[model samples]
Target chain A: MYPKKFENLIECLRKLPGVGLKSAERYAFDMLEYSEEDINDFIQSLEDLKTSIHHCERCGNLSEDNLCEICKDNRRNKNIICVVQHPKDVIAMEKTNEYHGVYHVLNGVISTSKGIMPDDINLMTLLDRINDETQEIIIATNPTVEGETTALYISKLLENREVAVTRLAHGLPMGGHLDYADELTIIKAMEGRIKIK
Target chain B: MYPKKFENLIECLRKLPGVGLKSAERYAFDMLEYSEEDINDFIQSLEDLKTSIHHCERCGNLSEDNLCEICKDNRRNKNIICVVQHPKDVIAMEKTNEYHGVYHVLNGVISTSKGIMPDDINLMTLLDRINDETQEIIIATNPTVEGETTALYISKLLENREVAVTRLAHGLPMGGHLDYADELTIIKAMEGRIKIK
Candidate 1:
C-alpha cells in the first residue's frame, strides 16, 4: 500500500504490458527516487516521442518527418517494395542489411474476423505507386494464416499487372534443428526448394 | 534492432535499475504501440507527479507540501516518535493503523563500509525534536546488521535522556515457518521474550 499519489503512479505503471503490482510498485519507487534532472530527462523524452514521431506517409513506418529515412534514401531501390504487416517488422528486416529495397508497411494484416478488409489498408496507394518502372513486389508477411491470406489477396490483385510478385523463401532458419522445425516450415522448404527457383 | 530514435529510447530505459537489454526493448516497443491517448496520459501523469509531489522536510516522506499528512494530523502523538530507515517503511506502518505517534525518517542506516555514520542521517534533527515532554522513541529499523548497529548507536546516545527506547518485536511472523526461520530471528525471539524491563 502507498499514498494516493504513489498509488496513482503504480496504477499507471501497471497498465504497461507484463508489469504486475510488485513491478509497478518498484517502478513507482524508482521514479520517486529519480534525480530531478533524470526525471526531467525521462519526461522530456516521452513528450518528444509523443509529439515529434509520426507514421511515414509513404510506408506507414515511424518517422520524424512525413517520409521515413528509408523511403527518402536515394540508395535504396524504390522499384522493389518489401511489404510487411507492422513497422517493427521493418526494423527486423533492416537488421539483416541484405535488402536494399524500400518498404511498404501494411500497418496490419487483413483479418476478416476483426472486420479488416483490403479497402481498409493502403492497397490503392500501393497500386498507384506501381508503374512500368516498378520491377518487383516482395511479400514479407509472417507465415500465419492471416498473413498468407493477405499475401494471396495482394498477389491476386497484382496478377493482371506486368510487375513480378515474390514471397520470402520459407525454410528452416539458420540455426534451427530439423527435428524441432514445424511441419509447415519443413513442407514449405521442401515445396519451394531452390534448384534454384 | 530498431531505428536510431527507438534505439535511443531503449538505451534510456536500460539505464533504469533492474531493467536489462531485453526488458528495455520490451518497454520501448510497449511505448511505441501504446495508444496516442494513453501515451499522452502517461506523460501528463509523469508531469503531474514531478510538479505536485514534494518530500516532507520534517520526516523525509513524500507529500504535497512541506509536511506529510501523517505529521500534520494533530491526533497523532508528537511526544512519541517511530524512527525508520525509509519513507516506504512509514507507509507500511501507516497501513497497520496501530502506531499513534509521529515518525522520524533517518533516510538511511549506519554503514561504516559505505562511509555512513550517525551524523550522515537526520539524527540531529530527531534529537532536537526530543524534549522533556517526549516519553518514548521506537526504533522500527529493519532486522539487518546495519539496522542493529544503528539502533545500538541511537540507544547509547539516548541512555542519559529521560526517553524510553523500544524496538519492534522480533519473532516468528504470523504466517512464518519456524523451519525456515534464521538463527538470528530465533535468538532475538528468545532474548526479547516479554520481561518487566
Candidate 2:
C-alpha cells in the first residue's frame, strides 16, 4: 500500500526489536518529513555504528577499540569478573553505579532447545582471563532457565580451578509488589530470604 | 555507558516515533547483531527511500514518479476526489477496496494550537484540480477537532465552486459498542441516523 522504496524502508525499520508493521509505517512516514540534513545525520550514525563499533577483545563488551572502557580502566578491580549474557547487561549494571569490578560478556547462553552449546559463546576467553590473582567470578546471567543452566555449567567448569564462582540472587525486584510478581519469583525470594534482624 | 558510535546510533533510532531511550538501545544492539550484508541492505533501503521516493505532483501522495499510480490510473473516477490529511490515510482507505476515486492528500490539517493554516497545506493544488466535471469532494480527514475544522474550512472554500462537497460519516465503527463510544461520537451517530425499511 506504499511506494516501493517507502515499503522497503518500512521493512528495514521493522527489523528493530518491538517495532510492528504499523509502527514501521509510521516511522517511514515520519522520516519522509525529516529535513535533508537530519536524514543525512541519521544515515551517518548508522554507518558509523556499523564501521566503528566492535566487541572489546578482553570482555566481549561493545567498544570502538580493542579494549572496552571498563576493561581499560586501571582503577577498576580486575581480580573480580562479573559474567553476563550480552553487552547490554553491562550497561544495565553500570547504570546502578554498584559494580566496581570488570565484566565478562558471554555474548550467548547455553540453550539446549536452541542447540547452543558451551563452545558457542565467549566462555573460553573467560577461562583464559582467570589467573592466580583473580579473586571471584560472579555469574550475573538473567534469572531464566537458560541463564541458570549456563551459570551452573560455568561454575561446574571452575569447581577444581581454586577460583570462587557465584550466581546473582533471584527475588522480586526493588519496589515490586508481591501481588504483581510471578510465582517463580516469589519462590526464589522465599528460598533466598535473609534474616535482617 | 555505551561507546560513542553506539550511543550515536541509539540517539538516531530514538528519533523514530514511539521509540524511547531503552527501546532505542535495544534497536542499536539488535542492529549490531545483524550480519554485515543485512546492515548494508538496511542502509541501502534508507538511501533509496531518501533518493527515489517523492510527492506525487498532482495529488501530493507519496510516489516514485511525478504522478501517483492512483492519479495515473484510467479506471479510477476523476470526477470524485477523496481529500485526506496524509498518505497513510490513503492506504487505509484503499485497504477497504470500496473507494474507486483518486485522492487529494492535504499533507496536513488546519490546527489553531499547532499554528497550521489551510494555506500551509496542499489546499491550493486541490482548488486548482476542481472543475465542472468534478462531481464530489469527500473529506476523509481524521475524527479529531482539527480534522473537523479542516473539513469545514475546505467545504466552505468550495461552497462558491461548482463541485459538491461532502464529509465522511462520523458514526460508531462497525463492531463498535455504543456503551464504549464517547459522547461526541454517539451524538454524531444520532445526528447521521438513517431510516430503516
Candidate 3:
C-alpha cells in the first residue's frame, strides 16, 4: 500500500512493545511529518544510546563510563547497596529521590521454569563487592514468586558473609483496599501490621 | 536517572503516541538489548521513511516515485476515481481489496471550525481529472460530520460535470448489532434499506 521505505519504517515501529499494525502506521506517518533536522536528531540519539551507554563495572548498572553516576557520587552511602532485577528498576528507585545509596543491577532474575540460572544473573561482581567496605545489601526484586525465590537463594548464599543482608518489606501498598487485595498480599499485610498511636 | 545518551533515547521514544515516561524507559532499555546490527537497520529504516516517502504527484497519495502504485497500475479502473481525505485513508481502502479504482487524496477536509478551507485541500488535480474520460467519482471520507460536509461539497461542485459523482453507501454494516447502533446510524440504515430474499 506504500513505498518500500515507508513499509520498512512501519516494520521498525512495530518492534516497540504494545505497538500493533495500526499503531505502527500512525507512528510512521507522524514521524514523516517531523522536520528533517528533528528526525536527524532522533536518529543520532538512537545511535548514541546503542553505542555509548553500557553497564557500569562497579554496580552492574547502565553508565557512560566504567562507573555510573551513583557510584561516582561521594555523597551517596558507598556501604549500602540496593540489588534490583533490571536497569529500569534502578531508574524507578532513583525517581524516589529518598535513597542516597548505590545500586547493583542483577539484569535478570533466576527463573527455573524459564531455564534462567543463578549464574546467568550479574551476581559475581556483587559477591566480590561484599567485603568489609559494604555494610548492607538490600534485595529489592519485584514481589513475584520468582523474585522471592531469587532473594531467598541470594540471602542463603550470603549466610557466611560478614555484611548484613535484607529483603524489601512486603505488605499492602499505601491506600490499598483489602477487599481487592490478593491472598498473598493480605497475608503479608497482616504479618507486617504496624502499631497505632 | 540515566546516562545522557540513554536519556536522549528515552526523550526521542517519548515522541511516540501513548508512550509515557515508564513506557519510554522500557522501550529504550528493550532496544538496548537488541543486537547492534538490528539497531542500525532500525535507524536506517527511520531515515529512509523521513527522506524518501512523499505525496504522489499524480494522486496525492504516498509514493516513492512521481506516481503512486495504484495510479501506475494499468489494470486498475483509472476512470473510476475514489476521492479520500488523507494518504492513510488510501491504505485503509486498499486493505479492503474491494476497491479496484484509482485514488485522489484531498490531504484534508473543509473544517470550518479549524479554519481549513477548500483551497487548503488538493482539489484542482481532482477537477482536472474529471473529464469526459472519467466515468465515476466516489467520495469515501470518514463517518464524521466533516466527512459528510466534504462529500456534499464535492458532489455539489461536480453537479455540472458529465461524470457521475457518488458517496459511499451509508447503512448498517454486515454482522452489525442494531441494538448497539447509534441513532444516526440506525436512521441511515433505515433510509438505505435494501430488499431481502
Candidate 4:
C-alpha cells in the first residue's frame, strides 16, 4: 500500500474515463514529480472548468457564456440547423468546413434500454427555436439505434411544420474498403444511390 | 476546439501518463459532469500529495513522517536491507509477504545512455546506512542492463566490508510455461536449477 495522500490522489485519478488502478498509480507518481506551478495551473484549470463553463442556452453546446461561439457567429446560417447528439459532434461537424449551419446539441439520444425517453434530452427546445424563416432541419445524430430513434422522433414532430427535415446519408465512408463495409451500410448505400449519368 | 477553460483542463489532463488528446478531452468532459464536492475533493487530494508526503529519512521510501512504516516497525529485521530502484518496487516486494527487512530506495539506476551516474542517485546515503549491525544487503533492482550495472557497482563497493551482498535470482517466474519462456530466462533457470533427490 502507498501513503495516505498518495492513495487518495490515485483514487481521484482513477475516476477519470478509461484510467485503471495501475494507470492511476502511475499518474499519481508522475504528478508528484510536477512543479508547484504546474500543479497550481492544473488545479486552477479544474476549478475554472467548474466555475466558468456552462451549456449554451440557445443550442445546448458547451460555452463560457450563455451562447456558444457558433451560435454567436453572425455569418453562420441561422435558418439551417444541424441536430446532433452531443457538443463533441458540433466540433466534428465544424472540422468538415463545408456546412455553415449552426448546431443544436441534444446532449443525449433516446435509448429505451437505458430508460431515456424523448422528454429526457434537449429535443423540445429545438422545436421552439424553429421559426417561419428556418429553412432546413438536418438530423445529424449518429447512425446507432438510439440516434435513429431520436432522429425519427424529431422528424415526426416536425411533420406538420413546413421546414424540410433530412437525415445524414448512411453509406460506406470515403477511402473505406468495400470489404470492410457492413451489410446494413451496404443496404443503406444501395437504397440511397443516385444516378450520376 | 472547445471552450478556453475546457481546453485548459484537457491540456492539464493530457500531462498524465498514457493520456492522449482524445482521452484528455473525454476526461475533461467527464470531470465537467462531476459534482462540485467531487471536484473539490480531487483538488484537495492533489494538494495533500504535495504537502504531506516525503521520502523516509532512513530508507528513502515514501512516507508521511520522517521515517517509513517499515523503518519505524520494531518487528522488521534491522540487520538486513533490501535496496530497490524506486518506492514502487518496495510496494511490490512487500506484496509477496516475504522479506521482513527495511528498504533503501535508490530513486534511480545508473544508466550511461540516460547520462545517470553513481552520484546522481541515493547511492552515497546507502553507504552511510551500512553500519556494523547490517548483515545482508539484497539487491532487488530490476534485471535490466542498468539494474545489473548498478547491482554490480554496489557489490564491488562492499567487497571489503563485512556485510554479505546478494543479487535476486533470475529464472523462469513461477507459473511460467517452459515452451513460452525466452531463451535467456531458460538459461538462467537451468543455471539456478536445484538437483532433485
lDDT of 1 by residue, B1-197 (tens): 34566667777677766888768776876787678787777776677678777767887677777888988989999998888887777766665555688989887889998999889887778888889999888876766778878878888888888888887666736444322445555446534633112
* Chain B of candidate 4 vs. true chain B, TM: 0.85
- Which of the two, 3 or 4, has more lDDT? 4
Backbone clashes under 3 angstroms, per model: 0, 0, 0, 0
lDDT by residue for model 4 over A1-197, one digit each (tens)?
68888888889988988888878878988887899888998889978977899999999999999999999999999999988888777776666566788989988889999999989998899989999999888877776777778878888899888888877665847544322445566446534533211
Error of 4 at A125 (Å): 1.2
What lDDT does each candidate get? 0.73, 0.80, 0.77, 0.80
- Residues A1-197, candidate 1: write the lDDT tens digits: 34566677778778766888768776877787678777677776677677766778988777878999998899999999878877766766665556788989887779898999988876667897788999888876676777778888888989888888887666846543333445566456534533111
On a 0 to 100 scale, what is the lDDT of residue B89 in model 4?
A: 76
Tens-digit lDDT track of model 3 for A113-186: 99999999997678888778887787777767777788888888888888787765656454332223455654
DockQ of every candidate structure: 0.34, 0.62, 0.64, 0.68
Instruction: Determine the C-alpha RMSD for candidate 4 after optimal superposition of all C-alphas.
Output: 6.2
What is the lDDT for B49 in model 2?
73
Docking class of 2: medium
Point to the candidate with the largest TM-score.
Answer: 4
Whole-model alpha-carbon lDDT for candidate 2: 0.80
lDDT of 2 by residue, B117-188 (tens): 888999889999998899888877776788878888888888788777777665756544323445566446
Q: What docking tier does model 1 reach?
A: acceptable
Residue pairs with backbone atoms closer than 3 Å in model 3 (clashes): none
Which RMSD values do the candidates have, in order? 6.2, 6.2, 6.4, 6.2
What does candidate 3's lDDT look like per residue over B1-197, in tens digits?
78988888899889887778878877888888888877888889877767678888989998888888888899999898988888877766666556688999988888898988888888777998877899888776665777778878888788888887766655645443222345566446434433210
